[model samples]
Target: MGFRNFRFQIVVRVLLLVATVFVFFKIGFNATLVSTQIFVGLLISGQTVALIVFMERTTNRLIKFLNTIKYDDFTEVFTSRGEGEKFDELYKSYNEVIKKFKDIRSEKEATTHYFQAVVQHIGIGILTFKKSGEVQLMNNAAKCLLQVPRLEQIEHLRAVSPQLVEQLLTLPAGQSAVLKLPHGKERVPVSLYAVDLVLRGEDFRLVSIQNIQRELEDKEMEAWQNLIRVLTHEIMNSVTPIASLAGSVAADVQDYLEAQPGTQICLEREETEDMGLALQTIEKRSQGLVRFVNDFRSLARVPTPKKQLFSVEEMLKQLQLLFQEEVAHENILFIVNCRPASLTVLADRELLEQVLINLVRNAIHALADQPNKTLQLEAFQDEDSRTVLQVSDNGTGISEEAQEQIFLPFYTTKPTGSGIGLSLSKQIMRLHKGSLSVSSELSKGTTFTLRF
Candidate 1:
C-alpha cells in the first residue's frame, strides 16, 4: 500500500539505466557487454512500468467503489473492486456491511411510523414529551381532553393546570398518577390519569382523563333509591301502627269516660296496659329514626388520611385474619392474589383497615347462601398504570340494575340488610382520592372494584 512513490522511482531509474547502456554500446565502450546489459535493463523497465500502471488503476477503482458504498448507491455493483480474485473477497465484506445498514434504516423508519400511528389511535390519551418539559406529540384524545387547539397541538402545554404539570414531573419515570378536577359551573368532574414513558433515549407521558361525574351520579342515585325504599318500609311499618294505636287508645278513653263519667276509671287496667304498649311502639320507631341519623353522621365524616405508605396486601391479610372465623362459619374461602409482596398506599392505616374490613365482610355476607361460597380478594397495580391499587372480589355479583344502588346508606340487598356498609366504604375511598365500583351479574357473582 505504501509502494507508490518508491516503485515509481525504481521504474524511472531502470529506464534511465537502459538508455545509458545503449549510448555506451553505440560509442564502442565495451560494446557487446553494455548491449547485453541494456537489453536486460529495458526488459526489467518495461515489466516494472506495466506492474505500476496496473496497481495505480486497481487502487483508483477501489477508492471509487468505496465512495459509492459510503453514499449507499447500492444500485451499482462493485465490478472493478471485485474483478480480481483477491479484490473480490474484500468487495464481498464491504457489501455485507452496506446491506445491513440499509436493512436497519428501513426497519427503523417502519418502527417509528408504527409507533406514532398506534400511540395516537389508542382511546387513552397519549402525549410524547421531552425530559425538559416540552411536548412532542399530543394525540387526539389528549388534545380533546386538555382542550388543546389544532395550532397548539404540538406546542408545549404550558397553559395546563399546574397540579397536573407538577404531578407529571414528580411521579416516577415509569409511574402513573390520577389528578382530580372538581365540578364547576362550566366544567365537569374530571379524573386524569398521568402515565409516564421511557423510550429509546427520550421520556414522555400520557395523561388520560375520564369523566366520572355521570358514573358517580348514577351510583349516588342508586344508593338514594335503595335507601329510600328500605327506610320507607321501616318507617311506615313503625308509623302506621303508632297512628292506629293512638287513635284506638284515644277512642277507648273517651268511651270509658263518657259511659261512666264520675268515680269510674276512664279505661280498664287492660286498656291502660294496651295504651302503654302503643306509646312504647311510637318510642321504638322514634329511636329507629335517631339511629338512622347517627349512622349518616358517621358516613359523612370519613377519617382524615394519615397518608403514609403501607402494604395493601398486608391490609387484606389482616382483614382475612380478622374475619377468618366468620368466613369459616359460612364455609367461605378467602383468596388473596396481589402484587409487590408489599402493595402499599399512602392512606390512614386505621381508616383503610376499617374500609377493607367492611368490604371483605360485606363480600362474605354477599355469598351467604350461594352454592360455591368463595371470596377472592386481589390487590394489583393497574395494568396500564402502576400507581393505582385495585382490589376486586368474586362473590355474589351485583346486578346491573342493583349495582348502581349498592352505595347508599342503609341500602342492603340482604333480607335483614342495613345497607350502610358500602356507603361508608365508598366515602373512605373518596377521602383517599380513590373509587369503589360494583360490576355484577344475576347469579354468577359480583366484583367490587376499589381503585386507589
Candidate 2:
C-alpha cells in the first residue's frame, strides 16, 4: 500500500528510524562498522523527507477545499485517488456537504424567481427604494402607472406627478395617502401604502400603489342613486296629496259658483267648514314637507372635523355624567370598562362626543320597554393592536338587512328618526383615519366599535 494508506505509511517510517537507531548502537559497540552506519543514516533522512512531503500535500488539499467553499465553487470535484485512506474519507464527506449546499442554493434561487414573477404580475404597482431615493426594484405595473419604461430613482415619478414624489419620499411607514395625478387632460386618484424593511443591513421602503378613481366613482354614484330614491319618495308623498286636494277644491268651488249663478257665491255652513279644514290640513302638510327638506339640507352640510388629542377614559366619564339621570330614570344598568386608563386618541373630541351621545341615546330608546336593560362602554386594544372604543347594549338588536343600510344617509328605523346620525358618525371616523363598525344579534344585543 506504500504511503497511500496513512497507517501503513506511519509504520514504515517508524521501522526505518528504529533501524537507524540500531545501526548507531552497533557502531558504538564495534570499531569498523562506519559504512553500514552511514547507509542507515541515509535511509533515516530519506524517510523523514517523505513524511514531510506527505504532510505538505495534506495541507495543500485542505487549503484547496477551504478556497472552494469560500468562493462557492461547487463545480470543483474532490477526488480520493492516490491520497491516504484518511484523506479519502475526508474528501468524500466534503463532496457530500458541497452537494447539499449546492442543492440548497438552487432551491433558494428557484423560490426567489417565483416570488419575482408574482411581484411583477400583480395588478397593484410595487416599488422598493433606498432612503436616498435610489430605486432597487420596479415592477411592470409601476412602469405602466408611471408611463415610464424604467425607473432608477424616485424623482423620476415627478413626470407623472410631483406631488406623488413628495408623498412617496416623506410619508411615514405604515401610513397611506391619496394623491391626484394628472393623466392626459384628467386626473386619476392614486392610493399609496408604504412599509419599511431592512435588507442586508440597509434600510428600504416598499410601497404599493393603486388607482382608486374607479372605486370612488362607483361608490359616489351608488350614494347618489340612494339619495335620489329617498328624495323622490318624500316628494311624491307630499306632491301627490297636494295635487289631488287642489283639484278637488277647484271643482267644489266651481260647482258652488254655478249653483249661485253670480260672482258673490254663498256656501252652506258644512261646506264652508269642510273647505276650512282642507286648507288647514294642506298647510300642515306643506310645513312638514318644508321641515323634511331642511333636515336633508342639514345632513348635507356637516362641517369638517377639527381634531385634537384627548384621553378616552375622561371622555367616558363625562358621557356617564351627562346620561346619569336618563339611565337612572330608565332603571338601566350602566357599566364603563377601560383598560390602561391613560389611553389617548387623536380625533375631534367634540364630534366624537356627539357620535357617542347619539349611540347611547339610541341604546336607551331601544331598551325603553325591555327588562334587564344593560349598557356597556369599553376601551381596549383589539387583536390587531388597534385602540378600540366600544358601546354595547343588551336590548333589541338590528336585523341583518337593516344593518347593511344603517350607514346610508337618511336611513332610520326609529319612528321619529332623521337617519343622519350613523352616517355622520361614519364620516367623522373616516376623517380621523379610523373606522366605525357594528355587530349585533337579533333579540340579544348590539355592539358598536370604533377603531383607531
Candidate 3:
C-alpha cells in the first residue's frame, strides 16, 4: 500500500521536491502566494525527512542484527514479512544463519564442559599452564598434592620444591621424570610427565604428577617378606640337623666315658666312625647353608651396570655359539631373530648377557622333557618405539601363582632352583633403566621380555 518498491519510493520523493520548488519560484514575492508557498515548503521538508527514514529501514535493522550478534544475544529473531518478498526472504535467511551459529556454539560449549569434567575427575594430578607461568587449569588432585587451595601460577610450587616449577616447564613430551618434595618428616616422590598442546591460538603444557611413595613402600615390604622367608627356611634346614646330631654326639661321648670307669673316654671303632660321619654330615649341611646365604647376598648386591652400545645381532650370535653344544646335545631347536639386522641397544654388555643367559637356561630346563621343544631369542623394536629383547619357549608353562612370585627373590618353581636367577635378571634390567617382564600360560608357553 505504501511505496513498496524501494526504487519507486526514491523517484517519487524527488518528483515531489521538484514540484514544490517550481511552485514556490513561480509565485515569488507576492502577498497572495505567501500562505501557499509556506505550505509547500513545509510539505517539502516533511517529505524529505520521511524519505530519509524510509531509505534507512534496512540499515537500521542491519545495525540491530549486528548488535545482537556482538552481544551474543541470540534470543531475538530477525524476522520480517510485510515490506516485500525480497526483504522478507533476506530477513528469514539472516535468522536461519544466526540460529545455526547459536546451535553450533551451544554444542561447542557442551563439549568443552564434558572434557573439563573428565580432566578434573582423573586420578592423576593434572596441571595445564601457559609459557608465562600462568596456570590455565589444575585438577583437584594437583591442588591437594601441591598442598595449595588454588594454583594461579607454576611458580607457586617453588615453596613445595625449588626445582619443581622449572622442571615442569622444561619437561619434554613423552619423557617422564621423578621429583622429590618435602612432606613433613618424609619426602614424597612424584612422577611427572607432560604433553604439549596449542589451544585458542596459544601454547600450553599439560603435566601429570603422581606420588609413587605408597607403591615403593609396598614393593619394599614384599621384598623384605620374601627375603625373611628364604632366610628362615635355609637356616632351619641347616640348624635342625646340627641340633639333633650335636645332642646324639654328646650322649654317645658321655656313654663311652661312663662305661670306661677310668675317668677316660674310649669310643669303639663303630662309634667313632658313626660320630665322624654325623659330624661330616653336619659340616656339609652348614657349608650348603653358607653358600645359600652367599647366593642371596649376590642377588641383593647386583653391581651397577657399565653401559655401552652394542649390536643385538652380535650379542645373539655370541650366545648361540656359547650354547650351541648344549642345544645340539639336547636336540633342541634354538632360533635367534634380529629384525633390521643392525639393531643395537645401550646397556652393560656383560649384565645383559647374564640376563639373557639366565632366561635361556631356564627355558632349556623347562623344555628338557617336552617333545618338539623350541626356544626363540628375538630382538626388535616394540610398538612404543622401544627396543625389546624377548626369549620365548614352548615348554611346560608356569602356573599363574608361580608367575606372580617368579621375580621375587628366593622364589622359584624348580626343585634345586637357587631362586636368584630371575630376580638378579630383573635387578640388572632395572640398573640399565629398563624392564624385565614375563608372560606365560599353562601348556601354551612363556615369553620373557626385556624392554629398553
> How close is every model to the real structure, measured as TM-score?
0.52, 0.81, 0.78
Worst 10 residues of 2 by lDDT: 25-34
Candidate that would win on TM-score: 2
C-alpha lDDT of all candidate models, in order? 0.69, 0.87, 0.88
lDDT of 1 by residue, 1-452 (tens): 32334455456666666666666456564655876666666766776676577668767767866776678665555443323445666667666766777787789989999988987787656665666766677777666666665423333343656666676566665445555543333555555556677789676665555666677799889767866787787668657877887788788778888888798575568877887987887788778778777776777677677889877777777777888888788887778777778677778889777777777777776777687777887777777654444334455667777777678677677876656778888888888888887777776776777777
lDDT score of residue 184 within candidate 1: 34
The segments of candidate 1 whose C-alpha lies over 4 angstroms from its true place after superposition are 1-115, 150-155, 173-175, 180-185, 188-198, 201-266, 303-408, 411-452
Encode model 2's per-residue lDDT on 346-384: one tens digit a residue.
788998998899999989988987889999998998887
Between prediction 1 and prediction 2, the one with superior TM-score is 2
Ranking by lDDT: 3, 2, 1
Q: Give per-residue CA lDDT, model 3, range 1-452, as digits (tens).
A: 55665557678888988888888788787897888889888987898888788868888888988887888888878766456667788889879878987998899999999998998898889999998989989988888778888988888788888788878988888789998877677789989998998888999898999998889889899877877887798689789988899889989878777778796677678878999999998898888888888997798789989988989999999999999999999999999999979899999999999999999999999998888989999999988889999999999999998988898877789988888899999989988889999999888789999999
lDDT of 2 at 130: 99
Name the best candidate (by lDDT): 3
Q: How does model 2 fare in lDDT?
A: 0.87
**Alpha-carbon RMSD to native, per candidate:** 9.7, 4.2, 5.2
With a 3 Å backbone cut-off (N, CA, C), the pairs that clash in candidate 3 are: none
lDDT of 3: 0.88
